[model samples]
Target: MDKQIIISIGREYGSGGHEIGRKIAKLLDIPFYDRNLLDEIADAKNVDAKKLEKYDEAPSRMFLSRTVRGFSNSPSVNIAEMQFDLLREKAAAGESFVIVGRCSEDLFKEVKGLFSVFILGDYETKLDRVMERRSLSAKEAALAIERHDRNRKAYHNHFCNGKWGDSRNYDMCINSSRLGVDGTVEYLKDYVDRFIKTL
Candidate 1:
């Protein structure tokens, strides 16, 4: 890619989006930011990283609209704004990177070469994948997936005021179950290459 490209990925609970984002970054020879973002935010704000993880993809009722409107600050909301600022700073500095989740689709909208993608899989596929990865039974996996997806949806809606996983919210929405992991990565690499060309 001749331009400074930043690929932002949003994903469902058990979708292979994280792996796909990592693979795309590897293929494109760029840095990958995911959980690492929490660490960076933690450092910048002088807060413990482990505490930030709970607030990572969660929309805290305490920190939502009313609190935001009143400026009744909470650590979680403060961290989120700080992280958004950090993302903006990184993009402004012309870094080529792939960021998974963290609502980058809306956060980096003004970025010149940013391409946002959403990844999802069928219910059964996601349940099976979560079961295998987390060593949980079918019922347990389904519950875990539900909890995660709900949290993510709430988080995205709170932050972006948009429907999570709606195709309209992203530059592309890929069904990871259809292509599997490696195939999804290949598809995204091609999609991103074409997107860069358009720039």
Candidate 2:
């Protein structure tokens, strides 16, 4: 706990990854970044937060340009660059925090205390959670899940060196369905403590 450490999480839709990350940050007494990262980016860059939200985790529409060089001058790419720049600035300042998504694993690969994890749940478990949380029908929830995951995968794979949600790319992969939210947070806290000790 004395040293600066970062926990970056990637997760499937309805996997409770955001809840787990928030709980972990509270337990560790560190900053937690998720959707609110857009606000930070907006404030830092003096841009409209609403504009950033449109391309938050969605991949760029300029497929050909992004495919050629991993990025383009589009708003999506510019926003991603700003986000990465903010993270790098914070990391350089020795900040300890938990960030969910945004392909943070690859972004902080060189940082000594970076711990990256991916969270997934069984299809039925995720589907049920999405239905309840979003107040959608089962079919609607399933479609949303599919669309969100697809977009996330495309975004991460486009910006990162490794495949999105691939276990090999992360320090650990957890099945959130097995432990649920609180239990998963507890487990991660223990795991993170042990990891920091080793560091």
Candidate 3:
């Protein structure tokens, strides 16, 4: 851990990406950013936290228009810009942290010692996890998963130069279902330890 390590995780809905990121941060003794990023942005930018939450990880309404001018001031777009700026500032200051989502992999491309990962689970596994976690019925969970994945894909594709969940965009692409949450965390911890040495 001699060098600053920034781990950016892209994940599918209910893939335990947030949990894995937090665990990795804890194991590595670094900061973890997820929904908490919105709070930081809200406080720093003097914006409403709740409003940012509403637009979090969602594509701009005019994303389909193919014209940046149309959605330049949109809440989603503005919030994304604010988040990116804050993250860039952190990176430029040599902060070592783990961040989940927010297209962080793309944000940190120029950063040294960045280990980007993407996690995806089988659809059935994701559905079951979502149902239990959200206390939703099977049908509701299925719809929620579809909606979230769709929105995340749209958001990432619109904001990033690379496609979401694509292996080529990340240093590693893991199927969390194969190793489960704890196992996946353990595996990533070891991989990150090795990654740090090469830095």
Task: Kindly give the number of clashing pairs for every candidate.
Answer: 0, 0, 0
RMSD in order of candidates:
2.0, 2.0, 1.9
Write down the lDDT of every candidate, Cα atoms only: 0.85, 0.91, 0.91
Clashing pairs in 3: none
Worst 10 residues of 3 by lDDT: 63-72
lDDT of 2 by residue, 7-55 (tens): 9999999999999999999999999998898998789779889878988
User: Which digits, one per residue and each the tens of the lDDT, describe model 3 over residues 1-199?
Assistant: 4599999999999999999999999999999998898999889879789877998888888743333655465778877878888989988988999999989999998888899999999999999999999999999999999999999999999889999999999999999999999999999999999889888
Superposed by TM-score, candidate 2 places the C-alpha of residue 173 at a distance from the truth, in angstroms, of 0.5
Off by over 4 Å in 1: 62-72
Q: What is the model-wide C-alpha lDDT for candidate 1? A: 0.85
Q: Considering lDDT, which of the candidate structures 1 and 2 is the better prediction for this target? A: 2
**Model 3, global lDDT:** 0.91
Lowest summed lDDT across 10 adjacent residues in model 1 is found at 63-72
Ranked candidates, highest TM-score first: 3, 2, 1
